[model samples]
Target: MSDVSTPDPRQSRLFTASELLGYLVLAAVIFIVLPSVLDAFRLNLFGKYLSYAFVAIGLVLCWGVGGILSLGQGVFFGLGGYCMAMFLKLEASTPENTSIQSTPGIPDFMDWNQLTELPWWWVPFNSLTFTVVAIVVVPVILAFIIGFAMFTRRVGGVYFAIITQAIAAIATILIIGQQGFTGGVNGITDLRTLMGWDIRPDSAKTALYFVNGVLLFAVLFVAHMILKSKAGRLMIAIRDREDRVRFSGYNVANFKIFVFCAGAAFAAIGGAMFTLQVGFISPTLVGIVPSIYMVIFCAVGGRLSLLGAVYGALLVNWAQTTFSESFPELWLLAMGALFIAVVMAFPLGLAGLYDDYLKRHIDRLLAPVDRMMMRRAARKTSPKAPAPTAQAAE
Candidate 1:
């Protein structure tokens, strides 16, 4: 008698229908019910979280999936933000008949610079089309060049992270030093409008919130698709064993650069959207600290899951906003402790834990159905009795 126990095949398929329904229901609650109930301030705060989500997406792609630790996403984010800020500032200044060469006599930093004429580079940014294009293109180009050089030279791991941090530091310092052009340490602020729309109005803020929501959805969808594709599989392979992948006929360098560039571009888009909503841009927003914070968001959310990155960014930022005002002194410490706890307890991240728990629940719920299907399949595939054996017996 054969005593082999066949394994159930139902466990192998990704995400069951009930699981999908649960996700859809959860999404509906967030995108539909929450917005309707939340006040404008809360909605705006959520919008800011969504911007952070954009940066977290990049972190997940590079660090979580591609094994590239980039500590300089803030630089790219700042670059895109400042680009938009420049155009907005130029537009606001020009209508008031202020020449780039003359002192605008508005912000203290610009006043102290003792300069008026808009820099040559600032001219193109005044064009809305140019600003929009720059927001996406500039970061991608920069990432491509930097990533191409670094990956080609085989610079990775902690060294790559250090280089990225250094770049972010340099960028912050450069923006601070170029007082005349970049508004120096004070950065750029006192923005009034974006693409000619009044940012101060409730309607505009609401519109901005919806825009952010749509962008977040779009980014999440794209990320999900990429993660499920052949290229994504190759990325995982490279992450697991780079040399083996190289030997298996894949150009590891190209894949790394591609993901790096894509992450940068996503960050830039988020930065631009953030600048538009906030109606302000500053170097502080794009410094080393913020870049590190971006990584923290991804780590806390569950680096391996795209949804985790988004959830982490939103949850962490929400906590910062909620507690920092009331307990300013303890806020940073609290955040740090929370991060440590998450890293220590849930190394796979909150999303990973949630997913694992969900899978277990689903397996239990579907066990009977799975067993029934397996039995039916087995019966159908079982061998028929031999008629000759019966006739011989008779």
Candidate 2:
């Protein structure tokens, strides 16, 4: 009689330490190598891409994970940028002529419009701390109010999308209309300083870039942790079946509102970072078209995957920058085509496709080893199997 030891059940499904170590090593290599290999111009481009990635991460949580298609992320982003811009403007403006109400004290557009003083509401934004806090807090508050009203009323799907889009459009119009206050069509420019640092300096640009990089990683890590938590699982459940989750004693409205507020805050933070990098903020940046484009990035990237959002933002923005420089007229068309192709061919987005492809390839490669193990088990179990017969069969 032959005795054969059974394979350990735990061994079949567990991740070994070595495997975990390998994954960590791979991530480290990517983070270290990618920036080092790129040139300064490319690095700047990457900074912009990272900002877009931040926005996309928020969209993934709200729209992709939560089943809400928000087309007004640009408005939240603009709000953050405008808040930062307000601080920068206040800091840059001469204290002697601080009153924008005076003829020469107003911004160029306001001066052009013959406006004398800054609006009352703009007074609070003069404080840098208040402006910075408003950048984050205001968007969240707005998101909460909107989400509460909509979700509680059971307004979702297309109606939600349309309402958000309309909100974005109206915001753009209002900003443009208030030329004296917002700088109108030209937006805000001549932004030379941010928190007393000269924005035009390469050193400041590099510093901002580093700050952006840290924020991106921080946001990504937080998102990764959330997606792995119980709340994240409940979010997924809510997305899949809101009615069921509601019946299961979960506060579906609260979950939706939380996700929405979180997403808005993410977008707002990205916008603030973007304003620092670009040294300007404008109404066009928050227009309906740009907001729709933000949605396109999430769509082209796998909505369900965080990595997909990041990659989509990076690739699409890179393509836009490159193609727009060479063929400005065709840039939008090219982007639209690319989005269509990704949706049609990879429905899961590039990351999802890559993951599925890798999984299938690994399964295929392991099939032979699995068959060998099964054959060995059969041979050990057989009472009178002949070695010569097995060798002949082999």
How high is the CA lDDT of each candidate model?
0.80, 0.77
Q: For each candidate, C-alpha RMSD in Å?
A: 8.7, 10.4
Q: lDDT by residue for model 1 over 9-118, one digit each (tens)?
A: 53232334444444565477557876899888778778777888898988888899999999999988898888888877766664354444346533335556775455
- Model 1 CA deviation exceeding 4 Å by range: 1-26, 97-112, 362-394
Models 1 onward score TM values of 0.85, 0.82
Tens-place lDDT per residue, model 2, 197-257, is: 8987666776777788778767877776777667787888988999999899988888889
Error of 1 at 217 (Å): 1.1
Measured by TM-score, the strongest candidate is 1
Count of steric clashes across candidates, in order: 6, 2
Model 1 has an lDDT value of: 0.80
TM-score of 2: 0.82
